[model samples]
Target: MSRPALPELSLLMVDDAVKAALLEDFGRAGDITSQATIPTDAKATGVIAARQAGVLAGIDLALSAFRQVDPSLDVSVLAQDGDKLEPGTIVARIYGPARSLLTAERVALNFLSHLSGVASATNAFQRKITHTNATVVCTRKTTPGLRSFEKYAVRCGGGMNHRFGLDDAILIKDNHIAVAGGVIPAIKSARAFAGHLVRIEVEVDTLEQLKDALTAKPDVVMLDNMGPELLKQAVKINKGQAVLEASGNVTLSTIQAIAEAGVDIISTGWITHSAPVLDLGLDIEIG
Candidate 1:
């Protein structure tokens, strides 16, 4: 099956992150083993290939690691982000000074494998609910410094990102509701404080709370942990007045039912926070 290409994330988006990672790995002396074992002028070729099947993401991040580690290294990408991968798929190629290549190896693989995992997980989860119009979305539960990269991976895997951060939108969760005394007040306060451009989404755990929250006319309402049956009722009660987001208990096994219940958005944290890393390896050929 042909899959459409996703927008490319420019290398600049992840430049600093890549540099930081490489710097952290380099430490004070930088690749001491490589420095000792390999001569500075020694040349080597490398092929980064997938050892397991998965989707591709974070090509730019991987490139950033290589380019930042040694600007003189020659690097080229064989597969772009969002592309499907199989065991033995060639992701990229690098030819450069042996020491530089060895120095950059782990950092490059780390970014590619982790982000690909996020994309792969999201793809699998979204496929479970393809029959329904429910959109697969990622929550804020992301690695602290890697939120943007992980969210970008979510998009690559055919899922949507909820909100980048608290500044982008107002999401009133259970704690906020409790602190404000009720859902309505929490949403109302969020609405009043936010400007005309900001969107407000309130979280509710029960039908009565859903009803009360609707009265405030927030942009979206999150149905927290409601089973399929309650979700169906919430859909009927909502009547398309607001975007209904079904969160909690979202897994590959439960996603289909959640989508069938008629919610517009199915948001989960597992895709980003708990995704396993895709296995990739750097095979070096010494000259």
Candidate 2:
């Protein structure tokens, strides 16, 4: 079935990069295997089905990629972003020239599967927090050239996104701490040089450093690698003076306990960096 036109679509730079990569993969010619095996004008229809339960993401971009190959290719979305899907659920439908569909198959599935994986991981992390005002967030730990897409997927799965880049926000981490001699100097330099609108966050590993960070009065304090009890104590010390973010070695199993520690934000690197690709496949219907 032909899907209705998507009214408004925002294109991130990552989307453009993905489209470029797809074009590069296709080259002046298309998939030679599909071209050799399938007749040029043969028509086909298929469903992109999920193989496991997951929060759906990237179908819109996948649809866009398919259309880029052939405007005549029909795409119908059976599910939207953030929707939970069971195995065998048809997330999308495509009807078009068999050759074009086959040619675009890998690119389409690659983006869809990876993005859905990110969304699924974010959803799992969010599920861990039982009772807390803290929000789960994703870090700069994202796939190269795909950061925007991955962050978008994180949002789809109910997680917040940190600064998209160094330009957007000033985050002083441990390395910066060492380079500047300590958290105070790093915070001082960032605060002095940063524009009035810029917000600075400093990461600290110890309560003593937390004290130093507090003196600097940063916009946020990142509690790195602290256990649950220590995190709660850190929260108590902050006393709402600065926003609190917990990071380092976060996992789904430990997130709820972390959130309950009263931190304002939890950032995980694994959700985008190491999330397993969601299982998806395009099955063609022979008629």
Best by lDDT: 1
Query: In candidate 1, where is summed lDDT lowest over 10 consecutive residues?
Result: 4-13
Task: Write one digit per residue (lDDT tens) for candidate 2, span 19-120.
Answer: 787888888876889878998889999789999999888876788778777889998899987788889989998999988888788888898999899989
lDDT of each: 0.91, 0.87
Give the RMSD in angstroms, all C-alphas superposed, for model 1. Answer: 1.7
Q: How close is every model to the real structure, measured as TM-score?
A: 0.95, 0.93
For residues 224-253, write the lDDT of model 1, one tens digit per residue.
999999999999999999999999999888
Candidate 1 colliding pairs: none
TM-score of 2: 0.93
Clashing pairs in 2: none
Candidate 1 vs. true structure, TM-score: 0.95
